[model samples]
Target: MNVQMADAEITVHTAASIDRIAPEIHGHFAEHLGRCIYGGIWHADSADGDGFREDTVSLLEDLELPVLRWPGGCFADDYHWEDGVGPQDERPRRRNLFWAQGPEELPEESNSFGSDEFLELCERIGTEPYLAANVGSGSPQEAANWVEYCNYDGDTELADRRRENGREDPYGVKYWGLGNENWGCGGQMSPEQYAREYRRYATYVGTQANLMFDHDLELIACGFEGHEWNRRFLEEINEAPWGAEFPLDHLTLHHYYGRGTNVAEADEDKYDRMLAEALEMERHIERMAGAINAVATTRDIGVIIDEWGTWHPEATADNGLEQEGTVFDALSAAAVLNIFNDNSDVVTMTNIAQTVNVLQCLVETDEDDAWARPTYRVFDLYAPHKGNEAVRTSVDTPTRDVVDGDSNDELPLVNASASVGDDGTYVTVTNLDCRSAQTVDVSLEGTDLNEDDIRGEILFAEQEPDYAVTKHNADEFTADDLAVPADGSSIEVELPPSTVAAISVE
Candidate 1:
């Protein structure tokens, strides 16, 4: 059979494999900042006064979230865990130093949702918990004590404290982040300084006296998106000054797009610029992966993009409640997720920044109800690939461009990746052209999918909130909207401008 696409071409050879998409790669990040905790996940008036909304939990569960990174973005650096434990009413309230730090007694913070609350939320949602420990202003003993509280099941003071707090069972959290953005918001530390600091924290956390459980603790060092930062840090971590291994399992990198990050969207070029910038996400991964591999002592060092998304500046310049996620943001997110899928070999995990009521969030709550955003819909569609194998793909498309605040650049008209599991193969393609529909031809090398088996669904402005970027559509989209054509060797689908399509054959 022959294949030809009108605008672009995509070829999938299923026999060749990249790597299994890490379920942790489908993780979500929830910070203590803004209403994400107080008003977004925690419900004060709900029938169950345990701090979370059943509705919000159900929505996230539907998305099949694999992991939750908690209590941070930058909040991890300044947060003190001891203050947020024990009974809620008896817990001390302090000023939030990271999100909105001010002079005495401002930005009131109630230590209502502490480590236990976060662990409970993780258990209820059935996700692995990844806690970012404080390293900037925290003592090594403090970080180790936090780990002991969560993972130790023996008879120690902290363990007894955990039992007294009502949780007798150890949470057994395995993922621990050493710090966040140590290159910038974390402490403005140089790579060498942070590398030394990481050794100090990781060493004691592993050697903590009461840690009876014998489990492999995955300690991730803070890494930046740039190749230079990653390269320098990896080089520094290779040294064995204490005659011990780096204790590094992964490196954490953060990347955010849009006006404030790398590119700007405005007027007629809004969607186009945003999509082009979003396409740059893959380049960031490639460059950083190359850097990590170059200096890494072994190839086992994984990369975790713990924070990433499209952040709008004008909406956040005043630092108000997070801007409503829009259909435009959905396209950018799909593109970013596709990039992660393509780079599954190096990326062990990737978490979208601020899962609720903050930067490209999934859900927002008001005085009356919770509103599901377009980004949530994208996450739902990508769930099948959580633990699936990433089938290698080949994309051949025309280059196009739009001007942004930085410069005009050419990017692919169609960007994509493919994943295969027990159900079938899922081919996710995003057409970056915001002005016209683009034709994409996909070839599956080893699957026996017939023309009738090919199906797809699309999300775009017309099919979304339309002119209302921030509008909430509580009335769910009910239709399956799946249809595509297939020849003997290829499946073909047309994606509208600035749209994302989930094409599957089951």
Candidate 2:
């Protein structure tokens, strides 16, 4: 179907303003599942010397991730921050009941990675820390103590404990999560029940700011997508005895593309399905924004896609939730990022599921060596769009109807979004078809803009068929893949099947 494509035109109205794209929208999630915490991001007395793997930090730094959500997808609720602090040997090793994907007790959580470790990791990679508190299995006092320990500079017991841990200055964590999925694994509570829990936690976990020291903390409540999660959460939250001015700053939602929510089981039509699902992200943003606006007491409350990206395959036996990245995955990522750019107004921050070795991970490591997957490459290409003003792009292209199993979906073979900044204009295009190469004509508008005045790079398979577009395993990867080459002009570009191209005017 892609092979039959001829030409397409993308007109970017640079004069039109589409809001500033927050770098946080390209954020990552690091869960305690699998190697994400253990082998992938942390190790003792190694390369970085502070326990984190050297190559892991180096690769993550390359992603330019603006925010990193720490600790637990489902594991956050069961987490007791107290168990992770103080001495490493003294930290308790608790049974992780979430990674087994059920009520069955399985796997052990080494509380080696705590608040200090998480904050330190964020500092090394220059990403803001978004800590999710334990609201399910832990008490309000425990959550409150963590806030004080991380943000308070006062001579309190918690602050003193933090000082004794060898870090004198506060971590000053601003983005705080009240809880994770309360409707599901977090608690399996009714929406009303979770809202009640949120109030209790937010009451104690106030901004953690004091007169002597001030920190502007943005609190996010665990929200849901699909179902009535958002409506029920927002509706009941206001009913919350709040005990103070509503502390909720944002609502959280999670999405994964596929029927079973596992990527390894994705069929041949996975790419087409992902493209269709990615397109639906725009509608999801709009609907969520509408719901948020309707019930929000504050004008600043927005939606954060805190946990997203594809989670394919059953977890590996020893590793659990580990996934390999693919070229199709890259295109899917491009489509999703473009949607985030389009809805830059309200969809402020998004973290791609688990950042390492887990679902949709950017980097997979074997012992000391780390490999940057195709998904990682996608983020690198989009780094320019961060904090840039979104430029409206109209793409006129042919459509293809993909019959994915029992579902029928229609989507454009070509998708694009553009942004303008002090540096220049950035236009990223994604082609869903994998059989044919496509040529697209792009124009940059606005008084200060000129698209053709810059250079471009393409990731077409035809140009480098031997290059590894994705890696199924560590041994199967090829490192010398084609960099987005600077051979072409900005106005004209070629896209091969399942390709993502970046055009820059710098």
Candidate 3:
């Protein structure tokens, strides 16, 4: 097949080879700051007695979420674990000064949703807990206490205190984050300073057995861009005078897509640029992971993109810290997931920027009404990729420039990835073009399958730049809007431009 381009003709290859695909990636992450905890996931007005919103829980259950991160973005740095524990009445509350504009308030520290509550929520949702500890403005002892509070089972002081507080059994959380965004919201520390603090915290926090029975507790040292922080962290751990091989299981990296007044006002060109930023996250993960692996070979440390998603300038408009998720956001999310699948070897775990109302949240709420955002739909579409091994697939297409007017830059037009599971093979293809649709032949080389055996489901909207959050049709969309593939396998189908199509082959 020949695709005519503005400047030249490009040949398309139908039978792309499957040889160099990466492993499948893991998903998890949520912060207590913003509505993520209060209005988002933990609604005090829940019809269910658990204080968790039934609608939210039901939506999460539908996605089959694998893991969840909690309690902090920048808020983790200033979070006092004691503030959120014990009795709600006895707990003191303080005004959140991190994201909030006004002065710090008091009597705001209710333990209604502290360690126990969070773990319970995770259990209800059927996902693993990824806890972030305080490093900035917090002492090493504080960090140690939290670990002990969650994992320790012996009759020690902390354990006894936990028992006195409420439950006697340990939560047994496996993943622990040292800090969040140390370069910015996490206290603006230098690479050397953060590395030293990471070593100090890792040395003190005791390890916990993995409750899920997969692997041991992983202590993730917070890492930054470039090789500076990675090198410093490895050096500190390797050359420690104590000679302790603290199990640094993962290093964290964060990236956000879209930087504009609002996602709605973001031009198609700018949206394309945001797609490039999402793609760049994979490169960042690759470079950072390589640096960490090179310095420490004995310990198996993977990369965790704990915080990532599209961040619009207008995100804080509705409630000062809330961001709207649109159809464009959904498309971008699909692109990001593809990148993660492509680099799953080193990029093991990722948490979308938030679970609820921060940025690119899966679901959004406003007092009485709750709706699944476009990004959430993308997650629903790609949920099957979770825990599945990734399969390699290649494409030959005419590449066109994705131009952004604001930045005056261009990115590639075609983006695609594939994953194979126990049931069948799944391929996700995206046409970055905003207007035109391109037809290409796809060949499955390794598997002996007929084209008629494949099934395809395409997610697209008639309107321009439709997103999950905004594309609400009161009559059409419902909780069931995000189910498995309804349409059986067909040989030819139109992949709507600027949309995601999930193709399943049995």
Candidate 4:
């Protein structure tokens, strides 16, 4: 196979800082769907006999995940917090409502891993918990009580229940989502209908901030990808007596691509198309931000891509939503994370769907052990960008035309984003071309670099675009030292096709 060498230039403007990239921007999501919660995070008959899987927990702990949204994608809308609380034996075995779970692949939830178990898991991993309250089939009082149960320090029935459940002190969960996908699986409500429901739920859940806990809680509302719907939703929300003072702090939407292209049957053309779809995340963010600006100008509402990643055809609900974690998926993740870093001003936090053993999961698990996937390597590579000041970058890169049906899309062969932190400036570049390498020249606008001040790491350079990770070969996907030759202010980086590289300058 002949490899084509493309050329590109990335100019990093270190002085033009966008905003402090919230560490929570690198957050993750884990729902009851598939094995994400059951065999992935918690095992019933493990060698340790503690229910929580140490192998999985260790990997998550190492990642130092900032925030984890729990109990849902669609599951949270119908989920009643009471059913999953109290004694394990007495806890009712309810239907999973949306997804098949556990090793059995059954539609029922054992309630073995409920609120307390989840909060405990969050504590064990030192990650903040972001709980999505029920709205579709639940009541406002139920939502309020769930908050009281988790965060209230006072002596109340809900607080007593928490004490009885073995947690004497409050969990102090900071982020709370009002619902999940309320336009579809949540309730199929119109923008006005969901907005009314959101206001009602926020009235109860939001009041607890003043009436109960000393700390404040952030209320998140579900927004749609359709900008018109989001505009209408915000318009309805502002109609409340409090207007923009409504308790909403964040607006969220889910983005998942690659549903049409299966990795098993993918070629270079398919990879290009999929990569193009992944880059569409930028448009979604801008549109949502526009909607917020249009209707709720006074409110400080940030954008959150709560559920975003590759949802391939292979990862169906029947098979626990498991799919091959491929290099292509990880490359797309690199591109998306770069977008998050660049848009850190509005993109406060984004949770890839999900954390483990499911669609675009960072880690995969078997009975014996859990291993990091290619996507996990991408997250590990981009970890330095968390809490950093995002700087602007201009990339003049080659493009390839990906013709899908009647539409023609231009896919940039090279893409990059840079950030400035206390350690120094970090720049991540992705070679989106699946069949060619790209030689990229990186230049910092005002700073000159020496060889000693630059360090580079590259991932998936030795693997093909379609390469999928497995338990035995998972270790092979770890990053390797890349040769970044620095001359004056410019650094030359040779990135292999379908690879992600990170360059740090002191």
**lDDT of all the models against the reference?**
0.77, 0.75, 0.66, 0.91
Give the deviation of candidate 4 from the true structure as CA RMSD: 2.4
- Which candidate do you rate higher for TM-score, 3 or 4? 4
Over 4 Å off, model 2:
1-6, 44-49, 100-106, 210-212, 240-245, 259-268, 314-319, 404-406, 447-452, 460-490
Clashing pairs in 4: none
lDDT of 4 by residue, 1-506 (tens): 12233299999999998999999988999998887888899995133325898999999999999999998889998899999888787888898888888888898888888899899999999999999999989999999999999999888998999999888999998899999999999999999999999998988888888868899989999999888889989888878776335568999999999999898798888999999999999999999988888888788789999999999998898898899999999999999999999998999899999999999999999889899999999999999999899999999999999899999989999989999988999999999989988899899999998989999999999999888999999999999999988778688888888999999999
**Tens digit per residue, CA lDDT, model 3, 1-506:** 12222221111122432233322144656665556776667764232336777777887877777888877777788888888777666666565547542112121333456777788888887888888898988988998888888778887888888898777888778778889888778888877787778878876764334332234667877777665777776776677666456457788877886775466676666666677777787679778877877778777777788878888876662353576666677777787888887677777688887787677788777556667776776777787676666665555545555555664444556566776667777777666666666553444554544645566666663535644444345323222211231222123334556767776777
Tell me model 2's lDDT, rounded to 2 decimals.
0.75
What tens digits encode model 1's per-residue C-alpha lDDT throughout 32-64?
A: 776677777885312233867777888787777
| Cα error of candidate 2 at position 395, Å | 1.6
What is the clash tally of candidate 3?
20
Model 2 over residues 104-200: C-alpha lDDT tens digits?
Answer: 2247776777788889989989999999998888888988888888988878988899999988998888898988988888888888898888888
TM-score for all predictions? 0.92, 0.89, 0.86, 0.97
Better-scoring candidate (TM-score), 1 or 2:
1
Report the Cα lDDT for candidate 1.
0.77
- State the lDDT at 419 in candidate 3: 67
Per-candidate alpha-carbon RMSD to the true structure: 3.2, 4.4, 4.9, 2.4
